[model samples]
Target: MAATTALDTLIDLTKEALDQAARLLAGERRTQQQVLQQLQTLNQYRLEYGQRLQEALQQGIDPASLLNYRAFLGSLDNAIERASQTLRQQQQKVDNSQRLWQEQHRKLNSYDTLVERRQQTVMLHASRAEQRASDELSARMSRNGAALLPPSDQSA
Candidate 1:
């Protein structure tokens, strides 16, 4: 019983740890998704700006205006690169969090299995003990009943 109690406590602790890991993993995934969305938005904006620059060139824009557009496009490109790097870093974090969650889940499962086995063992022992007691009681009652009867009646 004491062992079972200890195991139960351990199981509870493991479950809590697993829950925390799951939450962390979820948060990490959300952050990764947000980063990916931001990256995608940056790419789309860059593409549109490039298209606009091309249209302006075809229209024979002034040199100064062309330079400004080029400068702005360069800055946008830099921003996109940074966003891509950030997305990669965020993806790594998400992967690490996922592994941690999986490990915690496995630990919880192991503890649960142990607790289940312990409970089964205790139940089996209790059932065997009860059976033994019942058998003894039945034997005792038969002996007492036979003794209470006359010898001729007992034989019958």
Candidate 2:
């Protein structure tokens, strides 16, 4: 029946949507964790470099001619900090996307639930309709049988 086919299609679509949501959730979670780990690594590098710079200064390093040292350190700090910030932004974006996915998944589940409820209601109505039609047919058949019987051949 067309109704059966339509129901199957709806179920398939819902399953696909759920599958995509799960995949997106997994990928985004993985990416977020990776970014966080990268940030941690960058922080470690920055701290180590900072300590090295401090030790270099303490070792009578010429601050005047070592302008390149300061420049390199500054560049490293800026690059690392900027990368960390960008990663944080990306993490937030991923989190937002994940939230949207959750919302969409919830809405899809709600829609599926509504569809199932409607299907049950429709099946109930169909059962009642069939029962009514069967009853009408039975009544008509009984009437026909009674009329066809040899009622006129003998008085009750």
Candidate 3:
């Protein structure tokens, strides 16, 4: 019973650890999703900007204006690249967090299983001990009852 109590304490600790890990993983996943959304928004803006530049070229824009448009487009491309890289890094973090949480969850489950098996074993031993005690009491009662019986009249 003492061991079972200790195991229960350990299981509670393990569950708390697992919950913490899961929360961390969830936060990482949320951050990764936000980064992905930012990346997509950047790409869409870049595409629109490129289309505008093409239209201006078709309308015979001035050289100075053309140079400015191209420079801005180049910066947009760089920004888009940076966002893509950030998204990738964020994804890696999410993946790592997920793995950590899974490990913690597995460990917690193993501890729970151990506690359940141990409890079952303790119950089985208790049951066997009770049976043995009952058997001994019955044997003692039978002997006492036999001694208390009246003697038979076989000499008559």
Top-scoring candidate (lDDT): 1
lDDT against the true structure, per candidate, is 0.89, 0.79, 0.89
Model 2 bad stretches (over 4 Å): 122-156
Better of 1 and 2 by TM-score: 1
lDDT of 2 at 82: 81
Q: Compared to the true structure, candidate 3 yields what TM-score?
A: 0.83
lDDT of 3: 0.89
Candidate 2, clashing residue pairs? Answer: none
Give all TM-scores, in the order shown: 0.86, 0.64, 0.83
Query: Per-residue lDDT tens digits of candidate 3, residues 25-129?
Result: 899988888888888898898899889989998988999999998999899899889988988898898888888888888888898889788879889999999
1-156: candidate 1 lDDT, tens digit per residue: 787788888888988888988899899889989888988998898899899999999988999999999999899899999998998898899889989889988888898888788779889999999999999999999999999987676555
Q: CA lDDT of 141 in candidate 2?
A: 100
Collision pairs in model 3: none
**lDDT string, candidate 2, 108-149, tens digits:** 787778678988999999999999999999999999999998
Q: Which residue runs of candidate 3 sit more than 4 Å off their true CA positions? A: 141-156
Which is superior by TM-score, 2 or 3?
3
Residue pairs in candidate 1 whose N, alpha carbon or C atoms collide under 3 angstroms? none
Best by TM-score: 1
